[model samples]
Target: MSFCNPIPIRLKEARKKAKLSQKALGVRIGVDESSASPRMNQYEKGKHTPDIGTLKALADELSVPLSYFFCEDDISAELAVNLNKLSLSDKQKVLEITARLIDESKKG
Candidate 1:
C-alpha cells in the first residue's frame, strides 16, 4: 500500500499556531521570503512536497519534532490548539520543565 505524506497539513497547522507568515517561516528555513509564500501555499494545498531537508527546517522553525509532520490523524490539530494557547513565557517554562523531567528520567 502507498502512504500519503502529512507534512503539508501539519506544516500549515504548525505555522498558524506559531503565528508566523509563510514568508516568515520560509525565511527562518533559509528560503527567500517571497518564494516562501507560494511554496508554503503549495505545501498547504498539497500541490507540492518538501524534501527531508525542508521538512527538518520546517519542524525546527515551528518548534516541533520532525515526526510531527507524519502524525496520522487529528492529533496534530489538538497539539496545535494546545500549543497556540500557551504564552511565550508559558511555553518556555514547559520546555524547561520537560527538559528537567527528561534529565531526571535518565538518572533513574
Candidate 2:
C-alpha cells in the first residue's frame, strides 16, 4: 500500500513554525533567490519532492532533525522536533521517562 508522503505537510508546518516565507526558506537553504519561492512552493504543494541533500539542508536551516521530515505520524513528528530542542541530559531523562511509561502501560 502506498502511504501518503508526509514531507509536504511537515515542511509547511516547520516553515510556518520558523515564520519563514517560501522564498525566504528557499534562499536560506541555498536555492537561488530568483527561483526560490516557486521551488519551495512546489515542494509544499506536493508537486515536487526535494532530494535528501536538500532535505538535510532544510532540516539544518530550520533547526529541526532531518528525521522529522519522515515521521509516520504527527505526534511522533512533533515529539521529534521537541526532542531536538533538548540537551543530551534532558533527552536521556525523556528516554527514561518514556520507557517507564511504556513498561507501565504494558503491565496494565
Pick the TM-score winner.
Answer: 2
Candidate 1, 1-108: lDDT as tens digits: 977767787888889989999888888889887697888888888898899899888988888877778876777556654665689999898889989999999999
Q: TM-scores of the models, in the given order?
A: 0.65, 0.90
- Taking the tens digit of each residue's C-alpha lDDT, what string does model 2 give over 31-96? 999999999999999999999999999999999999999998999998999999999999999999
Candidate 2 Cα lDDT to native: 0.95
Q: How well does candidate 2 match the true structure in TM-score terms?
A: 0.90
lDDT of each: 0.83, 0.95
Q: Model 2, residue 44: displacement in angstroms?
A: 0.8
RMSD of each: 7.3, 1.4
Question: What range of 10 consecutive residues in model 1 has the weakest lDDT sum?
Answer: 76-85
Given candidate 2, what's the lDDT at residue 61?
Answer: 91
